[model samples]
Target: MRRPNIVWISTHDINPDLGCYAGVWPGAEYARTPNLDALARRGVRFDNAFAAAPICAPARSAIITGCFPTSIGTMHMRSKAVPPPDVRLLPEIMRAAGYYCTNNWFTDFQVDLPEIVFDDCSPEAHWRNRPTAETPFFAMFHGMATHESQLYLDDDAFAAATAHVAEADRHLPADAPLPPYYPDDEVFRTAWARYSDLITEMDHWVGGLVAELEEDGVLENTIVVFWSDHGKGMPRAKRWPNEAGLREPLIVSWPDRLPTGAGVTDLVHTMDLAPTMLALAGLEVPEAMQGVALFGGEGALRPQPNEFTFGGRDRQGEADDRSRTVRDPRFRYIRNYFPDKPAMIHTEYPDRLPTWAAFRRLASDECQQRARGELPSAMTAAQRAVVAQSKPSEELYDILADPHETVNLAAEPAHLDDLERLRAALDSWILEYGDLGAIPESDLEERWRPGGRRPATEPPEVALEAGVLSLRATTPGTLLGWTPDEPASAAEPSSFQSEIGLPAPDGRSWNLYTGPVAVGQPIWVKAWRIGFAPSDDIPVRVPVPV
Candidate 1:
C-alpha cells in the first residue's frame, strides 16, 4: 500500500476567529479567510481542539513529542536549554518508517531531535527535493505573518506588511467588541483590526501552498493539516488558561479518506496529532506517547469522543506563574498554584502594548498614592480591583453560560460538587504525568544547570563483544553517535561527522551498534543532549578474533 503524504501548516497565536468559526464579535466578518473557509468546507473541522501548553515553545514541544510539556520538563517558555535525549520526536519516527521529512526552517522544538529526523530542514526544504518520486513525504510549513510579534511592529513595518489589505477591510467597527478583561478603547480596536488583516495574509499563504500541491498533482494522495500553535495574542488570551489561550483551529483534509464538510465536536489535544499521523501511516504508535489517535483504521488507539482535555501554563518570559486547567465539553476548572501573584504582573513583552501600558501607569500611580497614605484616584474602583486582585486558588466557569469566562463559580455552593470533580481530575492528571511544574523554577535551574552552567552530557561507553559493538551511557535520555576513526588527511569533510544511531533501549542507556566493521578497525563514539554541551569522544579499536 502506498503511504499518504502529510503536509502540516502551522500558524502562531491564532484562535478560531475565522469567518467559518462564526465569530460574532464586531468586525469578525471582515476576517477575510476564504481559503481556510473553503478548506473547512472540503475537510473535517475540529470544534474543540486545544493546545496542551499556552505558550509557543512549550506548546510546540508537546505537539512534536506526543506528551505534555510539563511531563518532559519543558513547560517554561524558551526554557528548553537542552533536550532530554530519551524522548524521540514524531519526525524521527516517521523518518524511520522510510518517510522523507522536511521542515520549512521554523523549529521551536524545545528539545533536540536526532539529525536523522529531517532529510532537509531549512528555508529551501521541500518535498520536491526528495531523491525519489515514490518516497512518501512529511513536510511542515510554518506561517509567521500572524504571529503575536507582528502586532507590535512599528508603523512603517506594519504598513509595509498590510499595504495589500484594502482600506475598507483594514478598519474595524467603531464599537468593536472585545473580551471583558480588555479596555474597550481605540488602541484595542485598531489592534484587533490589524490582527484580522494579518490572518487574511496568512490565509493567502495557505492558499498558495494548496495551489502548489494541486499543480504538482499530489493533492489526491496527500493529507493536509492546518492549525495554530495556541490562542490569540491578546493580554488575557496568550498566557492564561482560558478558552482563548488553549482552544485552536484545526482542519484536516484527506481526499476520499475522511468525510468533507463534517464538523467533529470531540475534544482533542494538539499532542494527539503525532500519534494520529503515525497511525494513519500504518505504523505503531510508541508506547510512551500520551496522546491517542483520533482517526485511523481498526486497532488504532482512538480516544473516547469528548473526553476532558488538559492545559497548563508556566513561566512566560520574565513572569513566573503556574496554572493548570481541565476542560470537559461545557465546564472549565482552573487552579492557580501561586494565588498571591496578581494577574497584571510585570512582563516586558505585553507591556509594549498601549493597553498594558495604561494598566501599568495606573498601577504605578496607585503605588505612589499608597506611599502618600491616600487611596488610588487614577483608576475606578472596579478597574483597580481587577488590577490589584490576586488570582483565586480555584476558578470554575460554565463555558456554555459564560463563554468569556468572566464569572467565577468556585465560591458558589451550588457548584461545589462540579468543582470538586474537576479539581480531582486535574490532580490525578498531574500525578499520572509526573508534572514538572510542581518543582519551582529556581530549583529546576539548579539541577538542570549544575554549577550555574548548562549541563554536560556523559560520554557513552564502548565495548566489542562477540564481533558486535556495544554502546551505553549512564545519563538517562542521552543520544549516542559514532563514526569510524579516520585521519584528517585521508578523510572527506563528511567523515568527521558522526551519525546518531538508534536511541537507548531503556530510554536510559543501551544502544547496540549495528555496522559493518572489520576486526582491528577503530571507531569513535560520542554523546549529546539537545541543548547542552556534548561529551568528549572516546576511541575504541575493534579486537581481533582469538
Candidate 2:
C-alpha cells in the first residue's frame, strides 16, 4: 500500500467542547464546530485523550519527542531542554524516509531545533508545495483562533480573528453556561462567549483546510488528524492538572484504514502521537521514544493502551508550584508537592485576562465580606477554593460525577481503593521516568548551559570522494543536514541562516543526512544538536565526471 499523506491540524488551548462529544458541555450548544463534528463522525474520536502537561510548551515538547516533558527536563514552561543522545525528532525521521514535512507557522518545541527539520515551516507552508505530486507529505496546521491570547486581545484584534463568523452565530454572554469554579458574573460569562465564538471560528478554519484537501482530490489518500494541544484557556482549566486542563478532543480520519463514527475510550497521551505517526508511515518507532504507537507497530513495537494517563505541572511562567496527576478511566488523582501554595498562582500573564481578573475581584470581595461577618458574598466557597491560600496535599475526584473537580475525595473512605491505586501508579511512573521537575530549575540550567550560555553545535566536516559526499560532526549526537543547492551569493547565506533560526519560510533544498550522498555538484552541510544553536553551513564541491 502507498503511504498515506498525513495532515495534522491542531487548535490551541481547547478542550472537548465541540458540537460532537455528546454535546454535554456548557458552551456546546453555542459551539458550532460543524467541521470538527463532521470529522469526528467520519473518524475515530478518542474520548479520553490527554496531554502530558496542561501548558502548551511542555505538552508540545512531549508531543514532538514522544517522551514526557518531565523525563526530558522540559517540564517547566518556556524552559530549554537538552534531549538525550540517540533521540531524533519525528519530522527529521520522516524526512529521512523521503517525506516532505511542513509545519504551518508554530513550533514551540521548547528546544533549539534545526531548520532542516521541515521543508517549509511558515504560514505559507502547505503540502501542495511539495516538489512532486507523488511524494507523500506530512503537513501540520495550527489554528490559533482559540488561543488564550484571544480571550484578552484588543477589540480590533478579536474582531479581525472572528470576522468570518456571522453576528447571528456569535454567542450571548447571558446564555453562556457558568462553570462551578467561576463566580456568577458578566465578565466570566463574556469570556465564555468569546471563547465559544473563537471555537466556531476555528471550526471554519478547519473546514477550509479540509475543503482544500478535497479540491486537490487527495482527501481520500490523506489521513486527517484534528486535535488540541491541551484544554480550555480558563484560569483553573488551562494550567491545572485536572480534567479540563489535560483532556482534549482528538479525531483521526483515514477512510482507507480506519472505521467510521467510532469512539475509542482508551487512554491516550499526546506523547503517543509522535510514535503513532511514525508507525502509520511504515517507519520504525524509535526505542528512544517512550510513547506507544496507537495504530501500527509490529511485535516488540506494538502499542499497549494505558490503563491510566499521567500528567505533571511545574513552573508556569512566574509560579514554582510542582504537582503530578494520574487519571484512570473514571477517577483523577492529583498530588501537590507544595500544598502551601494556592491553586491559583497569581501570575501576571493570566491576571491580564478579564475572566481571571473577575475571579480575583470576587475572591477579594468574599474575603473582605467574610472578615466582617457578612451574610453573603459574591463567590461561593467552591469558587473561592481555587483562589484560596493553600491547596490540599492530595486530591481525588470522581470525574464522571463531578466534571468540575470541585469536591476532593482523597480522604473519603468510599474512594480509598481508587485513590490508592492511582497514587501508586503515579509514584511508579514518576520513579521509572525520573521527574525532572523535582530538580530545581536553577540547577538544571547550570547543568545544561554550564555557564548560563546556550551551547553551539560544532560545524560538520564535509569530504567529497568519487562524486560522493561524507559528512561528520565532532559534537556527540549531532545531526547533519545538507542541501545540494548552495547559496547564490555570500549575502544569501546570512539570509538563509536567519530563515532557519526563526520561524520563517524554509524553501531551501535541505535534506536530513542519514548516510553518504552521491552528489555530482557542490553541497551545503550544517550541524545541530538539540538544545544548542546550529552551526554555520559549510560548502563542499564534488568532482564532476568528465
Candidate 3:
C-alpha cells in the first residue's frame, strides 16, 4: 500500500470521557461526543496512552520530538532548553521525505524552532495548500476551545464560548461527576459542566474537519489521529504527574488499511507519535528519537513493546516541584523530589479558577474546625489530601484496585515488591535520561543561554551556478529555509528593504531547504538553529547562463 496522508487533530485538556470508551473510563455518561464515537468505531482506540508530562508545553515537546521532556531539557513548563545536538522535529523529518507538513498555528513545543520546519504553520494552514494532488500531507489541527482557560472564564464569557453547544448536549452543574479527591461544591460542579460543554464543542469541530477530508476525497487515503494534550484541566489533574493528569485519549482511523472497531490496551506514550508518523510515511525513524513506532506494518522500525510508561513534572507557573512516575499495567509508583512541598501548592494561573477559590475556602474552614477540637471533620481522607501540608517522598497505587489513585500504598508491606520494582524502573530511566530538572532553573538558564542572551543563527550563504541554487549556514547546526516566490513588496522594496537591499523574512511561505533547487527566479533564504533567532533574510539573485 502507498504511504498514507496523516492528519492529527489535537485538543486541549480532555480525558477519555467519550461515548466509545463508556465502560472503560469515568464521565462517559456526561460526554456528548457522537463525532468522536463514530470515528472511534472506524478505528482503533488506545485505552492506556499517557503523555510525558501533564502540562501542555512539556507534553507537546515530547510529542513533537519523540523524546521525553526530561531527555530534551523541556520538562519544566515554558522552559527553553537547548535541544541535544542531534535532535530534529517530527515535521522536519516528514518534510525531508516529501510530505507536505502543516500545523494549524498552536506550537507550544517549549523549545524554539526553525521557521521552515513545517511547510505551513499558521491558522490558515491546511493539507489543501500542498503543491500537488499527488503529494502525501501531514496536517495538524489544534483545538483550543477545550483548553483550561475555558473552565475559568466568568459566567458571561463561558456562556459565549459554549453557545454553540446544543441544549441537549449541554451539561448541568449538578450533573457533573465529582472526583472523590475534590470537594463536592457548586464551584467544582460548575467548572466540570463547563469542561463538558467545551469537550462537546471540540467534538463538533473535529467532525467538521473530518468531513472536510472526506469531501476532498482523501479520507480513505489518510490516517486520522485524534488526541488530547493531557487529561482534564481541573485541579490536581492539569499539572500533577498522576494518571488523571497525564493519561490522554488516542484514536487512529484509516478506513482503507487498518482493522476497524478495535481497542488496544497496550501501554503507549504520546512521545511515540513522532516515530509512528514517520513509520507510516515510509521513512526511517531517527535513532535520536527515544520513542519507538507503535504501528507501521511489517519491516517498520518498531521496538519491543514497552512494559512501563513514565511521566515527569517540574516548575509550572508559580509552583516549583519535581516528581517522576512509572506505571505498569496494574501499579503506578511516584517519586517526589520535593517531599516538603504540598501537592496543591499555589500557582498564579490556576489560582484564578473559581474551583480553586472554593477549595481554599473549604480547606480554611476545615483547619479552623480541627483547631476548635471538632471530632470527625466532615472532609473525607481523599478530600483532606488536597490540603495536606506536605507529600510523602514516595507513593504507590494499585491502579486496578483504585482507578482514581486516591489511596497510596507506598508504606504497605504487602505491596512492597511492586513499589520497589517500579521505584527501580523509574530510577533507571532517570539515570539513563539525565533529568535537567534536577538542575536549578537559574543554573540551567545560564548553561543554555550564556549571559542570558538568546542566540541567533548566522545568515545563510547562497550560490547560484548553472541555473541551480545552493545555500549554506556558518552555524554548525542551523536549519535552512528558502522560498522561490517573490517578496510581497519585491516590486517596490519597503524603507527597511531599501536600506538593506533585502526583503524582510516572509515566514509563511518558507520550505525546509533539503537540497539544491533549479533556479529560474529570485529566492529568499534564512537560517535558524533551534532555540535561536532566525537569520535575517538574504536575497539570492539568479545568475544568467554564460
Per-model CA lDDT versus the true structure: 0.76, 0.84, 0.83
After superposition on all C-alphas, the RMSD of every candidate to the true structure, in Å, is: 6.2, 3.1, 4.4
Clashing pairs for model 2 are none
Clashes of each: 3, 0, 0
Order of all candidates by lDDT, from best down to worst? 2, 3, 1
Error of 2 at 159 (Å): 3.0
Off by over 4 Å in 1: 23-30, 81-86, 171-175, 298-303, 362-386, 452-546
Could you tell which candidate, 1 or 3, scores higher by lDDT? 3
**In candidate 2, what are the lDDT values of residues 206-258, reduced to their tens digit?**
99999999999999978899989898999788999988899988888887577
Q: Comparing candidate 1 with candidate 2, which one achieves the higher TM-score?
A: 2
For model 3, how does the per-residue alpha-carbon lDDT over 1-546 read when each residue is reduced to its tens digit? Answer: 467899999999888988888877777778889999999999878888899999988999899999998888888887667887678888888887889999886777876546578887767889999999999999999989999888887778987888778898889988888789887777788888888899888888999999999999999989899999888888778888888898889998888566678878888998888988788777888899999788758422233358899999899876999999999989989999999999888898787677777777778888788899886365688887876879889999888889889999999999889988998999899898888888898998888788998787889888878878788878876888788766554245355333211222353477778888886877788888887767777888776657
Candidate 1 or 2, higher lDDT? 2
Q: Distance (Å) between predicted and true CA of 478, model 2? A: 1.9
